[model samples]
Target chain A: MNWNGIAAIWRFEMARFFRSIIQSIVSPVLSTSLYFVVFGAAIGSRIPEVEGVSYGAFIVPGLIMLTVLQQAIQNAGFGIYFPKFIGTIFEVLSAPLSAFEIVIGYVGAAAVKALLIGCIILGTSFFFVDITIQHPVWMIAFLLLTSISFALLGFILGIWARNFEQLNLVPLLVVTPLVFLGGSFYSITMLPPIWQTISMFNPVLYLVSGFRWSFFGMADVPVAASLAAILLFTALCLGVVWWMFRTGYRLKS
Target chain B: MSAIVQVNGLNKTYDGGFEALKNVSLDIREGEILALLGPNGAGKTTLISTICGITQPTSGAITVGGHDVIDDWRAARKLIGLVPQEINLEPFELVANTVRFSRGLFDRQRNDAFVDQVLKDLSLFEKKDNRIAELSGGMKRRVLIAKALAHEPRVLFLDEPTAGVDVELRRDMWALVERLRADGVTIILTTHYIEEAEAIADRVGVIRGGELLLVEDKARLMSRLGQKELRIELRDGVEALPDALAGFDLTLSDDKRSLLYTYKTGEERTGITRLLSAIQDAGLTLADLQTRESSLEDIFVGLVHTEEGEPS
Candidate 1:
């Protein structure tokens, strides 16, 4: 199993994360606070309660989802890409560890980093709004699944990308817009029928909906459908990652 | 000694249709140093990379300590350590942590004492806490060695270990290689410096045009293929060779003050006495006589030149 090898990679990555601990923790926290001020305080005052939950509390899960997705992608993407860029990836490739173990080490560390940021934003939310988790276990499960799935996607992105522009392309141009349009700051039910129908194709919408369901116990879509969406998304990403390693995609020539 | 590393009929062709290695086969003995000598694009690095499992071979089998490098890579890789030619490192990581990280990568149990010893052996103990970016080029090379040794592999591959280091560090590195050999570790180093091989390798392998031209015991190869030159200096300069010395194959110096006579070292009769007698009969007063042996570099150049069908 090469448990020690996996631990070594995990620890090495975590050390890099801790080296920039202040920036890692503060950026998302500050953004989450700003979103609350703009959307929760000022806008919520003019709007009525959203599906029996306060508007401020309504956006908490979406905010966590938004940040977790971004952090997971960026952390895992940069984590693997930097090694490739500096040529230190040769060490990892030549080691006794297998592809599965290597992926676990890198993706696990990145998932943990995103999970930490998600938790911090959750804590920061307590100060801004009154919140309750009707399904705490489900919330944790959703958070873990989303972090791991997106981290896997990020790992694939890292391997597939050849330059900095390509590395940042999907996360910035594709993911950020999807998150904003996928109802991170509002409910999809508030959109028109056609837009709501189109939102069904946005993968991030399911992540936010399932996560919000764990908090308020009221979701725009059925919880089972959202759960299926994330599970299917995770499986798809896993398949791509498996193919990348098996074929030695960008990792080996 | 029994072979600890065996490569059989290995071939590698890159996707771009570049044939980097051509049916290369080799056996590295345990506790002995083998030097691979070649010029650029001669497949030395590709061969090492394949055996270490960094580059996948197009075809052929390789085993380290009786374990297949492909199917049983976990076990085989655990027994090998590699120091690549490039100095790739985490600039922000501490020196000590980099070594420890490599040890763990090999799945070795955490042995702080051993890691510390490796650092001390490399003279990097004082800089253990410093980031890699803070070190000089020579010091970073030391860190690379430290990391490779941290795992304590039975077989080590040093690919151009002394390529860009200073003279003092190169000497120190050579000394360290000898110490490692004393501990019974098998070392294979590829280098452009023929002198490095002559000084340290038990056997020298010459590779040219993606093929291993020869691998033989250092002393035996030197004696078998090496040539010696005898130079006869005369008190007076002559513009042309004398008729009496015409029977011998000799070259006159451009200034015509000395004559050069070449002979094989392995020959039963060099005919030096006959040549000298003839030179004296030619009425040339001998001012000085000297003999010089060809170096490994000379032999290497001759071999490469012969392979290319050039005049040597």
Candidate 2:
């Protein structure tokens, strides 16, 4: 309810993001560009197009999703964790701000940062391949929702982690593997029937499929399922965060 | 004077069953400076944390300005500010922005003028635009004080405000605390330095083993516990104490060149007159006599040692 408190926290976090502007923006852009070179130029030349779209253009949504998800989690995770690590979290805890405001401030800033990185990658995609969005609104919608949900997950991760190794554990080990195996480079239909069935269960697949559908109007699974999956994940994360603040779990001792 | 903060039977036991605080109760008068003195792991921080609502109490209740800390935390928190033991600030953020942001966190309306004044008060105006990382340890501590004062809360909790600071900075901090007190802010500080409490606190609270042993006016505590020592020098060394001087609590020096007598300053019957008359009657000629009163440090050491020696 304290709008000023929210803005103050939001602004402070965003200022920290801008303090290391190049590192925040360039790392993702450069990695996405490399992906374009290796996957779009090198592989697309021999593999041909998938789903009637060039391999380079078809993977754009997947690449954006991959970058957004990683950045959201990484940025948000480090954001909250650093405060706890250095003990500045007391400033927030002692303030008049509620847990909801604290979340909105931190997660909100992380989502915005991820969204900005996603746009930069989206722009980078234009140089190597001709791409068009079938549904610009849905594309943005999916982009925002995905960024927010992952940022929420990152917030939880930040609180849950006790050390540096634990903080990076989920994103580096679990999320990266799921993204790679979730049809980021090729269509799920290209896989064997059994592998395709397994791929259907990968949560990242629905995120990528729905996002890709917004760009190419084609999806491996029903678009509604993708939307439902994201909504459910968001709700679950919110529920966990609410409980965290309520019980002072990990945050208060 | 009215009490600004009231705690009734506050207790805190960690998850591992370590009781950090036990049946702690206090009343902090408005506009008064109170100091909690304790050694490391004596639960000084825990008591402050519990009152500030950063840590939950296992049992008991605390109210600030008549608002319950548990049920109405938001309102209660708005009335208080805390400068924790840790020196934590966003290293990348500007000092001015840091204070401003801290104020905003309290839901206080934007008052850049007030922020500027706080920086000025703390002599942090020159470093306003500088990043916290660039500031020295002393300056960083000042920034912490500035940040706490940004919201202009009625009560301020400074936990170890002078810990790890140089003597000069510590002096400056004490002066700042005095200034804050002059401005009608109720301040509660925790420290292990007896001199700090003797210098700045109107009242002092002693805690040990998760319990408050005493809370009394600083002047009264010192005077009531103060004991005077009388050192009497003898012209000739004595192989043994004379029977006439046996009525007094006296001890001879190892060299047998002097005798020592200790008596309470507060007691009506100090026994000093009787002891001196006994010494004269014993034909023990006194070459010199010197009297000394105990300091707060002596009393503090005695208090802690006595409690530590007893059964829990």
Candidate 3:
């Protein structure tokens, strides 16, 4: 019930983000624009269209997903990790805030950061390709849900990591590859039957499919299945976070 | 004064089987200064951290202002502020914002005026707009104090607050502690500097090997265990101590120019009169006499050495 405490943490984190506003906003925008130039301009010209949507427009949601996923994990991971690294976490630990409030503050700010980057990339996509959102509300929901979920995962990573290298380990080696292989640029339907079957195991595939469905109204997986996948994934992340705080894992001895 | 902070049967055993605390019990009276004196790795920081709810106790109960530190942490924590041993600050954050942030974290309203006053009190008002990284080491320690005081808690724990600071800053900190005590804030500080405890603490506690050896009123602890030495300088040198003075608890200096007599301060009779008479009868003429009292450091060293089974 410590609303002020939660707001304090949120404001403190947002202040840090604002301090590096230029770098935070510009890096992802520039990177997403590059993907548009490389995949939308050069590759889309050869492909023409996939499932009645232009190849360039097809990758827009996927590109936003990619950027949102990476930024969310990175922002939230570094948000908590930096405090641990410098020993300032003692302040938070000693405060009159609850674990739930702490999570709400850290994860909430991180989600907001990821959503900002996602929206900016969405705006940047307008300049690169002609796009229409058939389900704008669903798109926002998907974006918000994904940001919160990934930020929670990032919070876990932050607590678990002992060093900078370990902090970057999962996001780099595990997440980026999963996003790329999960059909960020191409539809899973384009793959062979065997590959498509294997792609079902990749959780990122469902997130991208559901997010893309909100844009094109066509998805590789059924809308309900994609929705279920994302909801289940969010619950899983929440459970892990709850467990972490409950046991004081890596946070208290 | 009533006990504002109470710790009972506290124990902390880390995963590696290292016991940081063992059945530590204490009661800090409201509006008094209690100093915990110990050597390095003596559970001082760990004890503070546990009471502040930064570390979970394996088995214990700690209550601040009648609220349990674990179960009712929100209320318990509202009554406490902690200045940790490390100088940890957000390097990029402005000094004023840093203090404000701590206040907010404790669920206090945004009181810019109060925050400014705290900064001024710590002599950090001039650097309030600067980033923490821009300040010197002493200033950073001041900022830590300001942050801890920002929330205006009833109990404050200062863990080695003057470890590396210069003499002037140390004196300033002592003065600040006195001012806070006058304002009715109970304070507990941990330090290895026996002089710091001697100068400021109303009561002193000594810990070693994760065990609290004792806690008592500063003056009482000194008087109860303290020893005094009387030195009698002779007019002439001698080869050895005379038989007349041998019966007394006395030793001659290597040059035989002086005799040293040791006695407890609590003793009803120091035997000084008898010793002087014996020296006179032994045909020794006194040139001058001097007496010295043992310091807290001396008593601390003796206690620790005795605990370690070493000669004191």
Candidate 4:
């Protein structure tokens, strides 16, 4: 609640951000652009837009989602992860800082990193296609919501991770695939009705679909349902993180 | 004069049925540097972590500055600063920022001037802007100390702070600890280095195998339990001891160049002067004489090694 508490966390995180500024900026931008070239251009011409937009333009939100989610998750994950890795977590754990203080500090930092990546991808998407904003408010809403949600998820993952390799497992293998299956690039409508129904089960579908709706004024999922999923996921991740802090689960170990 | 930390009947058992601490109780007096000495797996770190509120005890209680460590952790933690054995810092952060961040954790006001003084005290002022990874081992250790000191906690715990460190840094660190004690900070140190405990600790607490052995003032414990030795160098080397001197409880060196005599303080004379006169009668001459008191290391080893009571 206090600015100084938040400032303490924000400063530490921002310093880490600047430490790898070149890498954090370059990796996501380059990766998302390549997604545009390969998935948008190479495959788009073969298939028409399922939702009345060019395949290139349709994929823009997904690419943006990719950068934002991964970077946000990693930003928060590494922020907490490296502390335990280098054993400096003892300093934070022993300090007068409470569990809530730690969450706010690290999560705020992650949101900033995810937001920066989202903005860069949105800015650079102009070169590949005619990216238009159908509703700026909703766009900002989904951007903030998705980034914060994933940042919380990453914060939990970082504390639970026992080693460096274990930290990579969730972000790379589990999360990236969930994004792919969540309708980031392809419409669940294009699939058979059975698979489309299953695609609805993926939580990420709502985030990407909702974000895409903000741009094109349409989506396979309803705006209301998307918003619900976003709120629910955010609440869930925050609850789990709070529990980790409260119980001192892997953080103590 | 009251206790800064009061631990009552503390016990800890791991998930696998391994008990690390059992019914341990002690009062850590304010403004005194108490050293906790033990071998590996003696539950030193476990006890310190529990007091810091990072690990929970399976049973019993601890209070720091009259606040229960579990029920009122924020206030209790605010009063205690713990330096773990590891040298972990944010590799990307500057030294000054690291210390400042620690202060802010306690919701303390920003005092750049005080932080600067702490950096200067630790000799980290010159590397204020340097990244943590850029500093050497000793500097990183100092950074941990500076971070712990930044919040100005009343109690500071150093867990094996100088383990694996060189002698020069170890001495310098002990000197700094003495200075902190002079400033009225209560210090609890755990070390495998016996000399550190003997050199700096006002009172020494030894724990072994999940049990508290004894806690006592340094000199009192030394005078009460420590044995003294009298060693005599022989002017003439002998292949074997004479039968006439066999009645004395004396040990001969392997080379037969010297004799060592040990006696309890409660015993008088130990017949040492009589033995010297008898040695001259036996035609053996004395070259030199020396005596030594038992050290803390000797007492600690003797205490822990004999607790099982099988001549181990």
Candidate 5:
């Protein structure tokens, strides 16, 4: 993709973000704070620290990740969705743009929004908990990887959803439960061995673990393995998107 | 003239077995504006969508500038631009930026000059910096056209370009369309506005029930299918027509102010003199007369209504 084209897309994407400041900034911050209040202050007070970190500090990454994940999915999905909703996708599709150009233009812009919101949540996080980055580079890398990954997943959702309500099903029903069950607030090591095995089955556990490992320098799963799992998931979603473009799936037919 | 677009045996059947276009084939000549006309659900939009590659054809093939629309959409789409009937644009972006970004989508190097020219041509330069939401409905409609023309496509498709536009804006857009045609853009417009087709189309094609009913030059189609109506105004108003005029095929006005005589198309002698003598013999006074040629609207109505009468 041309840098100029990418810049054009990025600029347009940023404009859309600022266009709805209420959704982009206010909603995420308010919702994450509530999660902090409920899951952190209320629930974490009773549970002991799983890995020498304060329960409030331990749950911070999970709350941020929840906002980041949902924001990323919604940004990417809605970036594509509203065009089809109002019938402007025709302009995009009919342009001389290749499938690669479209994916990068749309998915890359979505990742930028996700990353910005993640950073905002991080900055606000310091207000509530005395948080320090154990490995700033690892945290940034995991934040980008997970946001881009979920954004691509959301891009797929945008294409497949034909109606408004149908758009909410996957994120609200499936992804949220997976994020909650994933060891964001407490370590899987703190769970019973049976449920710990089940937690391992949740792909988001690997992402939350991988991201949490960045902040605290420890994770319920091996940090390297978790990193590898997140990378694999990202690659798989990218592959699905590439296949969709090649076959014109849900696009032409 | 070489064919700019060739559609052969195109068939599109939706999932529930509703065929939208059935084995439709045609060659659209280069540099001519072809108007596709039909009633609602007549496959006009489907045909244009298929040609533009917005909707996939279930069977058969399409080529633009000799490039297959499916196999080589890049080249094919580069040659075509479509302005859909709906006023769909990025609600937040400035008009200039939206048009500029559309050009960039084609990976065209920043051609701000071309973008500016399109804006000026569409009379959108004043609204260039305005967000799309700030524009009036007519301005928004013009923005859609400007976006479509940003790349200077060779074959432009306008699907109901003036569906809801006010008369003044519609005429302005029509004038702009004429200017584009003069610049050698081959336009294919689908419209329910039969008057628009009459006023602007070089050739017109009618489609109904998933089938192309006819395609002909504007003048030839009008002359060939065109009927003549002899509407005679009475110099003296009467309650009813004379019994001597019973042999003629006609309709009497309910108010008895006029008599309508239907005649063969383009007939040199309408048998008017004999009819007048008959009226005179019936002791009716002379009346002024007027004649009207069949409008494209009349022929179109005749075409679709006859199909309704056909046995299924």
Candidate 6:
């Protein structure tokens, strides 16, 4: 329903994405390339391999997940937050649009932006390291679902944040740190048994493990478990989004 | 003319228990400009917001074109366009794209011709390709109006459309409003500028402290509450009031050079004849005499001030 409205919002967001080509599309590609250079060069020399995979290749999914998760959230969070900040959100609120359609437009475009960055990083990783995909379909599936889920999370953050500081609080303070600690650079097996148990509690660990499995066919957790984690988290994010719209939490006011 | 938008017993109390509206009711006839005049904090914006579905009412109901604003919001909203008080446009978006995007949001089919016309009408066609950040303040306000009109709605709400614009743009906006009226669009605008209401509004509603004191035809309200003043300049200064004029309700100027007589215009007997006769009988020589009618501004100030329990 209201496909025109949805498309208008989506297209407007995408246009904005392209307009800021350096910040939106190029920065992630360049920064993640630096991650490859720093992590692959400095760390790969000593620890040549982990689980029979090169240290350089092993970190590819971790890097992709790290960037994808943060970008998805940041892109969407800023997407909605800026409009609300400058008061342009009233245009969308007064339009003949449902909450679901609004979410789809902003989150959908944000997820797509994150996916573009993820795919670019994947392409750029081939230059620094040797890599293979044992399950290309699963890689794509995980890429899509993870992008959408994190984008939804970002959408919620956008609405909940009242100021600019709060907008970046979660992605910078919470998500980036979790990505680093969630096995982005090294395997969890190298950790002490107690730390490994605790690391499993980190949601980002499941995403990286599952994504890594799709490439190397070796993972820290069962593929089914990772899939279940993503699905469950997605459901939770969806529930929150639905509740936000239903109550008009920060939007209606 | 049939009622295009009807609001009945509408009430809005904010989360902190501040009541912004109280049992407000109104019927907007098709193709008439209704001006809601009120001072700041008078709930004018709240009333417009509730009808546009931007703010939910705590109680009561509203319908636009016979569609309930709540249950059939999509249908109701399609017929309404709002130019809000705030001028908030995407700074980076192109001007033309802004209007097109708004049309698309209304589910309107592609109509470049219509968008083009709206831009042209708002005198923004030349700046269509420029980003909003580059446009001047007057141009930005025009962009807001163009965006509101892009979908060709049956009813349009302009909330303080000419609040801080230059005289040229204000006149341009007023001309545009008149053009829209000629095209059969029902217009509802809220403003504190009494002159604006007097100039363009077919009907005027005075609102104060979340209460609508009156809604009447502009001409009728002016005549019904309109008062006249008679100023009689004396040939010389007087130290004291004349005993012959003691029967009249009159005030002598501090210098005692003139006398001011206030009377209702609606009364058949304005007492002007008697007052003039009294002045003549008192052997007062009048140097000059003038009669002036009160403006809507006076009536508005009177209404809002009196409602606040203050002397007007």
| Collision pairs in model 3 | none
| DockQ of every candidate structure | 0.88, 0.81, 0.85, 0.56, 0.49, 0.78
- Give the CA lDDT, 0 to 100, for residue B193 in model 5: 89
Q: Residues A87-177, candidate 4, lDDT per residue (tens digit)?
A: 7777678666778778888998999889988998998899898878999899999999999999999998899888888788998998999
TM-score for each model: 0.98, 0.96, 0.97, 0.92, 0.89, 0.97
Candidate 3 lands at a TM-score of 0.97
Candidate 5 at A11: error in angstroms?
Answer: 3.4
What digit string (tens of lDDT, one per residue) describes model 2 on residues A1-253? Answer: 8888999888888998898998999989999999999998998788878868999899899999999999999989998999999899998998878889999999999999999999999999999899999999999999999999999999999999999999999999999999999988888999999999999889999999999999999999999999999999999999999999999999899
The positional error of residue A224 in candidate 6, measured at the CA in angstroms, is: 1.2
TM-score of chain B of each: 0.97, 0.92, 0.96, 0.95, 0.95, 0.96
Q: Please state the error at residue A147 of candidate 2 in Å.
A: 0.6
lDDT of each: 0.93, 0.93, 0.93, 0.87, 0.85, 0.92
Summing lDDT over every window of 10 consecutive residues in candidate 1 chain A, give the lowest-scoring window.
A244-253
Q: State the weakest 10-residue window (summed lDDT) of model 5 chain A.
A: A1-10
Model 4: per-residue lDDT, tens digit, B132-181?
A: 88999988999989988988989999999998888878888998998999
Error of 2 at B205 (Å): 1.3
Alpha-carbon lDDT of model 1: 0.93
Please list all clashing residue pairs in model 6, or write none if there are none.
none
Predicted structure 5, TM vs. truth: 0.89
* Predicted candidate 3 versus true structure: per-residue lDDT over B134-250, tens digit per residue: 999999999999999999998999999999999999999999999999999999999999999999999999998888889999999999989998999999988888877778877
What DockQ results for candidate 1?
0.88
**Model 2 residue A200 CA deviation in Å:** 0.9
The C-alpha stretches of model 4 lying farther than 4 A from their native spots are: A1-6, A37-55, B237-244, B266-285
lDDT of 5 by residue, B202-307 (tens): 9999999889988899999998878888887777788776778888776888888888887767668768778777777877765677888888999899878887
Over B78-117, each residue of candidate 6 has an lDDT whose tens digit, in order, gives: 9999998998988999998989899999888769899999
Residue A99: error of model 3 in Å? 1.0
What TM-score, to 2 decimals, does candidate 2 have? 0.96
Q: Assign candidate 2 its CAPRI class.
A: high
In model 4, residue pairs whose N, Cα or C atoms come closer than 3 Å (at least 3 residues apart or on different chains), thus clashing, are none
